[model samples]
Target: MNRGLYEADHEAFRDTAREFVIREVLPHLDRWEEARLIDRGVWVAAGTQGILGLSGPSDFGGADQLSDYRFRNVLLEELAEVHATSLSSGFSLQDDIAIPYVAALGSDEQKARWLPGMCSGELIGAIAMTEPGTGSDLQGITTSARPTGDGWVVNGAKTFITNGIQSDVVIVVVRTDPGGGRDAFSLLVVEEDMPGFSRGRKLEKIGLHAQDTAELFFDDVVVPHENLLGELGAGMHQLATHLPRERLSIAAHAVASTRVVLRETLEYTRTRRAFGRRLADFQNTQFVLAELATRLDVTQAYVDASIHALNAGELTAVDAAKAKWWATDVQNQIVDACLQLHGGYGYMTEYPVARAFQDARVQRIFGGANEIMKHIIARDLVDRPDR
Candidate 1:
């Protein structure tokens, strides 16, 4: 099926992204994975190549491409082609989750101070929402920020933060009005070297070893009033507004990754022999590939439509949730099936299929678990019974 999603400009940008990945990313992946951290130099190189901050303001060196997400989609597709899940995840955090908040909601001073560095990769950004005790329930967060003479004193900890170890600026979600209900939270930007601010050990995971996921701590860390983002007590609203984009970004990666692994597996089956015949000659293999291909195509069409809707500012939270959960589920299933087709060799770390198998498992768990996604969809369905 024809995707018809990318224009000529997007295709041209895709070539540039592909070249950048081959030259800058692929060579360092193994070393980064071994060290459980990516070098900051690669980030700088990406910045120099105009790969970071694509949707940021033009004054801060951003390409201001927010209206068109196809550029970001192209970059993800290229990264998927090479099985660079860790790097993809890291970049997505910066581009999709962190940048949008700063670019869209930060004050002028905040924008001037951080956006340039962020665009240039001089400063890495991370958003701290998930606490040790809280995952999806923002209402349950206990991280508190109390008023002080000139600033707010923050005390709390966040776990499972992407770029947690390397982030130079963190947007911490803190409770501003302790007794207030949904409007109690606020976003405070915590810069590096703020007193009492520290990081826990980089977490070990079953996959995405090169991506830095860790715990962050803030005790008596002073965040000046100037560093606050958006409305003082509107943190929940801000987060809600940005989540659709974040989930759509995840869905984009999920579909792209599934396509990459499927293509590779198809080539492998055509060449690898089984019982004195090509693996592709087996009836079961053909049927499996056919089914996977059909699923990918159908899911891709919906994702593509969602992307267009997002650009048009019409994508809803419910729709984004649908795309995120369904696409990730498909990605995991397809990748697992592809690995099974590889026989014993699939279990080896040297094979991309084995690595993909490890990386795909988290898709269903993160970006609000698939169960949460279904709940959102069901709630919407119930509220609008006419549809």
Candidate 2:
């Protein structure tokens, strides 16, 4: 089916992104995977290519025309084609998750100071939200930033933080006013050079080998009061305001990753033979593949519609939840079936399918769990007396 979701400008941007990925990222994927983290130099290279910060202001050395996120969607589609989910995730974290906070909340001085560095890849940004005991429960974080005369004193720890090991500046989510309800939490910038800010062991994950995820600890890490990301006691609102973008980014990845596995499976099935007959000759295989293709087409449509809605600023959290959960669900199912089609080779790490299968498992769990997504959707659809 023809997907007319992107304009000519977006198409041009995709071409640029593809060139950047193929030249800089693809060649380095294997080495990075073996190392378990992408090299810091690549970030600088991406900045030089003008691909790192697509959504920052021109004055800040970022792409000035980043209003529409469709460019990023297309970039994910291209990267996903090569079965590089880790790379896709890293880039998405930079362009989608981190840049938004800088653009939306950072003050003029902050923007001038950070945006240029962020856009140019001189600074890698990360947001620390999930702690050891809390996942999806934002208010349950035990990390705290206590007020002081000069600034604020932050202390505690965070786990499962993406880009933790390499992030130049981490936006640490901490409780500022203990009894301030859901509003007590606030995000403060904790720089790498801070006195007591430390990154713990880089946790091994089932997939995303090239993407760094780690635990962070803070002990009397003082953040200048100006480093507070948004208004004090507005952490929930701050997170709520941009979650739709985060979810949409996940949905984009889900759809793109599905297409990648499907494409690879189709090619493999056509070439591999059983009893002198190509695997594609089997009726059952064809039927299963037909189902996958149909589902991909259907979900891709929904995802594209969601992207459009995101651009128009009308995408709701409920709709994003629907896209995030459903597309990832379909993405996982398709990959699992595709892996089954590969028989023994599917389980081997040598094949991209195996890695994708493992990596896709985490999608339903993060960016808000699939269950949480359902809760959000349910709230909007079901009538409640409490409301």
Candidate 3:
């Protein structure tokens, strides 16, 4: 499918993004993977090139009015073509996860304190929601911020936080009013200079190695009252509202990645031979690719539609969950099969397919696990007593 989702301006942005990746990103991926994190300098470089601020406002040194998701989809697509998933991941966190608080919920002072630094890449940002005892269970979080004289004192920990260590400022999800039921949670911006705030090890993961996922701790750390993001009682609602864009972004990457591997797999199968005959000549290979292509198209349609719905403010959490899970599942299947078609070479580090295989495994796990996503989708279904 041609995926008629972008205007010429988006194409122009794609060209710029492609050049950024070629010039600033791809050359550093291996080193980043080895170091287990992206250097902070690249973030600055990205800001200068205007790749880091898709959703940020023009006043904040960002692009003009690309708060729409379609622009983001194009950014992901261009980056995905080169298998630069880590770069895509970092950009999504900045745009999808962290920036919105400033855009939608920040006080004028808060936005002033953050947005300029963010746009300049001078002050990095992160959101810490998943804790030691809770992963996807948002309401089950244990991090606490109790009342202090002039502020609130936060304590407890978070794990698997993207951009954790590198972040100069972190948006921490904590229980502000314990025993107030699910509405007790609140988001507080914890600066790195805050006392007793610490980071645990940079976690080793199955994929997305370049992402700086780590454990963060707040021990009797005081957060000024002004650091609170959004209404305290509305934390869940805020998260729910923001998650659709995040999941949709992930789905976009899923489809883009699938196409990359699928393209590579097709070329490989056509040239590589078995018993003096091309692997593409095999009925089994043909059948599998056919099925993969169909899956790709169907999944692509859902993703494309979800993008449209998102722009229209009509994409629900359930539909976003469905798109995220299905598209990633399709990406996983296509990449795995594509790898299998390459035989042992697929397992080698030198092969891009091999690296892609490692990278694609996490798609279904993060952004809410596929199982969690299905549960969300199931809950979103309209109940019929007669059925």
Candidate 4:
């Protein structure tokens, strides 16, 4: 399929991204995974390579490729080609989720203070939304920030935060009004050296080991009013506006990963012989690959459409939800089938297919869970004005 999603510039950018991934990311993956943390140097290298903060304004030392998401997608595809999913996840958090929030909503002063460092990779950012008691329920957030004479005092804890350990600044979702409702939440920027702020243990996960995921704590941490991101009590609205991009990023990665796994599996089926014949010669193998190839192309079409809608500033939450759930589900299905085709070798951790299987499990779980995605789509269906 000639998707025609990327122009000549995107292909040119892909060349740069591919080279960077091979030179900077691939060799260090194993070492970082063993350490359970990615080295900070790679982040800086990515910044220098103009890969970290594409959406940021150029005056702030960013690449300033704000409206074009194809560059980001190209970079993701390159990472997937080598199965560096941990780095892929971390970079997506930076480009798709965290940086966009600041770029979109931060005031000039706030932008000047944070955007330069963030774009230059001197600062890493994390969004602390999930708490011990809350996952995907922003209304249920217990993290509180109260106004004081000087500023606001924040007290809360967040878990399952990507970039938690290495984050130089965190955008924390807090309860600004004691009486909780839609208008009660606000976003506050919590810096790393802020008093009474601490981090918990780096969590061990089933995959994405090189991406630092950990717990964050804030107790009587005073954040100045200047650190406030966006309007007070508008966090819910802000989150809703930005979520489409995050979900779309996940979908994009899912499609790219499935492509890689299927490609590798096809090569494996062609070479490895059984019963005096190649595995690809078997009817069963042919059927599986044919079905998977069709599914991959179909999923890619929708996801690419979603990406275009996003670039045009027209992608809805419902549409993004559809892409996120469907693409990830397909990704998992393809990986599992391809792994099975490898027979016993699929179970071994050494093979890329096995590693991809382990990494693919969390795709459905995160980005607001596949169950929540269906709920979003279903609610839209029933609540439409035409209905």
Q: Which candidate wins on lDDT?
A: 4
Tens digit of per-residue lDDT, candidate 3, span 1-387: 587888999888888888988998888888988888888888898889888876777877766444578778877888788777877888788888788667788888888888877876777889888988998888898899998887899999999888888888898888988898878988899999999999999999877778888899999998999999888777777888898888998898999888888989999999999988999999999999999989998898999999889888899898999999999888988899989999999888677888888889988988899999999977656463544
Off by over 4 Å in 3: 64-66, 382-387
Tell me the whole-model lDDT of each prediction, alpha carbons only: 0.92, 0.88, 0.86, 0.93
Model 1 worst lDDT run, 10 consecutive residues: 54-63
> What lDDT is obtained when candidate 1 is compared to the true structure?
0.92
Per-residue lDDT of candidate 4, residues 62-130 (tens digit): 788768888899999999999999989988888888889999999999889998888878899999999
Encode model 2's per-residue lDDT on 130-153: one tens digit a residue: 988998888788898889987899
* Clash list (residue pairs), candidate 2: none
TM-score of each: 0.99, 0.97, 0.96, 0.99
Rate residue 305 of model 3 by lDDT.
93
Total residue pair clashes for candidate 2: 0
For residue 355, give model 1's deviation from the true position in Å: 0.7
| Weakest ten-residue segment in model 4 by summed lDDT | 59-68
lDDT of 4 at 262: 98
